[model samples]
Structures are given as structure tokens and as C-alpha cells.
Target: MKIVILGGLGNLGSQLAQTLERDHELSVFDRVDFDVLDENALLNILKDIRPDILINCVAYNAVDNCEDKKLYETALALNCELPARLAQLALQFNFLLIHYSTDYVFNGLETKKEFSENDTPNPINKYGESKFLGEREILKQAENGLKYYLIRTSKLFGPQGGSPQAKPSFFDIMFKLSQDNKELTVVNEELSCFTYTPDLAAATARLISSKAVYGIYHLINEGAVTWYEGALELFQLLKQKVAVRPIRSEDLTRPARRPKFSVLQNNKVKKLRPYQEALREYLNNL
Candidate 1:
């Protein structure tokens, strides 16, 4: 299969590229080569490549920064308008569209209840709202005969780093802090799965190949943990004696509101390994 991955230089995108390149023809488009906001470029690329699958990892994911009114236009363009346009192209070209969304679509009001694919989206912040809108656009296209898969994931982490486009994952930050012998401060109030990108990318390949029934699927590593706990586990894995301080979400004072508990229940697909096992594998590889 000929596959084109947008934002292919980023964390998850890079992993997808690496995973699928072995078995399929892959073309990766990053921000340097292709901008999601540039509709003409996007359209031309799609028309030229006409790939069997177009996996979009592109997103305006600076959570708190997305709340800024100044960034609203860019956010809407990348998070909503771009996907909608891609959906239109998918309809025209008849290619499978696989888009990544977030667990943030949920309000996180009910701490005890794990959100499933069937749960109604009630985004609490602009970032979540934008992602939810993206999902809606793709689903709308699916309704109109576009083959689409919306994978809602949370707390994505991976081992790939060092490139200018490579932003460190949460685990990376903790690992670096531990190396520096610096104390870590993490929010304990929020709970979500720490999905490993390699695992997600592998599962995605399987799902696409299997031709699974799809609309919205929660594709995340099994089990949930607070940020503080995740950090402690990282420290333990490293055998680093760095002190980790737990703080409430409110104490951080971020611009965007976060879901207190955005753990997604994987009902549709269940191929991913547990978060702890994934983390250990990543660490061992590193």
C-alpha cells in the first residue's frame, strides 16, 4: 500500500513511518515540506500521490497556547479546517483516512467512569473543542461515503528524539530531569494512559491491514496513571534518586482547562500492551 503520513517528522508520525515503511510504500510530509494550513499544497500533494491511505498526525496541540485568541485562526485551520478538507479529498479520491484525536474530547467530570467510544464528547477547553470538531468533520465525511478511522489516544510518549522537529515526550522530560539530579514536579489530579507511540503505530498498521470496522476507536496503552505516578515509575526504571513532588492541576495555572480524568476505555480494539510494559520496553530499548 502507498501511504502518506502528514506531520511525519513528529513523535507519533515518525513512529508510524518507521513501523509501516518496512511493509508498505511510505511518503512522509512534515511542516518543513508541507503545511496543513496551506490548502493548495495539501490538495496538490493528495492529487499527485493519490495514496491508498493518508494518516494525519498533524494537529495544533499546544494545549494551553491553543486557548489564545491570537492563535485561534491557526488552531481552527489545523485542528478543524484541514481535516474537513482532507475528508473532502478522501471522498473524491476514495482513499482510507486515518486521523488521530485525543481523550480530551471528554469533560472528565465523572472520575470513576471510564469514557468509551459511545460516550458523548463534551470538550472542556479550546484544544479539546478543536480536536472534537476535527472528529466531527471526519465522521461527517464517513457518513458521506468516506472510509475513515478516528483514533482517540492520550498521553503519547516515544523514544525518537534529537531532530529539530522532535519535541521530547513527557517521559523524556522526566528522564532528562532525573539525569540532571533535579527534583520533578508533576500534576497528580489528572489521570490518563501513557500511550507508547511504537505500540500505537504497530496496532494502527494491524487495524488498517485487517480492515476493521471503524469510526472512533480508543487506541491507547492499557491502564491509567497520574502524571506524578508516571514520573515516579520513570525514576524507578532509571534508578535515579530524583525527588518527585505531586501537585494539584489547579496549582499549575495553565491557560487551558484539563480533564481531571480522561482515561479512555478501548472497546473497539484491544491490541495494545499495558502502559507499564510499554514503558519498560521503551526504556530498555533506550
Candidate 2:
């Protein structure tokens, strides 16, 4: 199958492109090459490419910065607006549309149960609201009896196609601080799943190959832990001794609000294999 992945050069998009390339003809379009903000240009590019699958992976992931109205507007364009337009094109052209979403759509107020597709979304920040808008657009506009596999994931990490400008990941910064023997403080309060890019790619490939089960699906690696635990694990993996401190979210100052417990339940995804097991495997690869 000919596949076109938007944000193909991004962390998760690049990883997915590389993995999918072995079995399918692939073309990746990143922000530098094809900006989603330019809808006409995007449609032109898509027409030229005419891929069987158009994967929308580009997103404005700057959680904190998106709080600015201008930034939030741009985020909405990248996350929701363009995706809706692209979905319309997919319907017109009869191509499968695979879009990525976030686990942030839900506020962390649910005390007992894990978040599922059916839960009501109450985003706490602009980022989450934008993502939810994208999901809503897809559901509203999908056509051709199309197969729209909307994969909702979280805290994605990978080696290549990482954030440019040396903007360190939670793990990246922690590793750097540990290397310098600097004590690191992480949030022990907020909770969610850590998804490795390659693991997510593999699971997505499996889903694409198997059933035509469409609609929304939560695809995250197993286990829910706080940022503090994730930092400790990284240090332990590196065989480095770094003093790590755990604190609450209120301990830090940030522009955007974070979900308190946005851990995704893989009960449906676990029918394949728990993402936790996949996460351990991915860590071992590093």
C-alpha cells in the first residue's frame, strides 16, 4: 500500500514511517516540507501523492506554549482544523485515514476507572481541547464507509525524529541532569502511560493488517506511573546514581495545566499484548 504520513519526520511519525516502509510504499511529509496550516497546499501535495493511506500525525505538541491565544489558534489549525480538511479529502478520494490523538482529552478527575473511548471529554488545557476537536471532526466527517483508525497515545519517546532545538524529553532532560550529577525534581502527582514510539508503531501495524475494526482505539504501552518513577527507571537503566526528588504539580511553574491522572487503559489493546510489556521491551532496546 502507498502510505503518506504527515509529520513524517517527527518522533512518532518518523518511527512509524520507518517501520511501515518495510511492507508498504511510504512518503513522509513534515512541517518543513508540508505545513498543515496551508490547506490548499496540503491538498495539492496529497493529490500529487495520492496515497492509499493518509496518516495525519503532525501536531502542535507544545503543551505549555499553546496557552497563548495565537499559539492556541495555531495549535488548533495543526491539530483540528487541517485534520478535518484532510479527512474530507480522504472521503472524496476514497483513502483510509489514520489519525493520532492524545489521552489528554479527559480531565484527571475520574477516581476509579480507566479512560475508555466512551468517556466524556473535559480537556483541562488548550492542547487537550485541540486534540478533542480533531477527534470530533474525524467522527463527524468520515465517509465512504471509511476505516478511520484514531490512535490515542501518550508521553511518546523515541531516539530519532526527536524534538528539534535540543528540547529535551522528560527522559532526555533527566538523563542529561543525571549525567551532570545534578539532582532532578519530577512530579510524583500527575500520572499517565509512557509510550515508546517503536512499540506504538508495531501495534498500529498489527491493527492495520488484522481487522477492519474502525472508530477510536487507545494504543499505549502498558503500565501507569508518575513522572518521578519514570525518571528513576531511566537512571536505573543507565546505571547512573543521580539524586532524584519527587514533588507535586504545584511544585513547578508552567503555562499549561496537566492532567492529574490521564493513564490510558489498554484493556482493549491488551487483547493483543499489554503495553507495559511492550514498554519494558522498548527500554531494553535502548
Q: What residue runs in model 1 are displaced by over 4 Å at the alpha carbon?
A: 161-163
lDDT of 1 by residue, 39-117 (tens): 7898888889889999999888889888899897678889999899999998998899999999999989865699989
lDDT score of residue 166 within candidate 2? 22
lDDT string, candidate 2, 200-234, tens digits: 88888887777657878888777788899888787
TM-scores for every predicted model: 0.96, 0.92
Model 1 per-residue lDDT at 47: 87
Return the lDDT, model 1, position 174.
80
The CA lDDT of each predicted structure is 0.88, 0.80
Residue 43 accuracy (lDDT) in model 1: 84
> Cα miss at 17, model 2 (Å)?
1.3
The model with the greatest lDDT is 1
In model 2, what lDDT does residue 129 have?
A: 97
Distance from true location, Cα of 282 in model 1, Å: 1.2
Give the runs in model 2 whose Cα sits over 4 Å from its true position: 162-167, 270-286
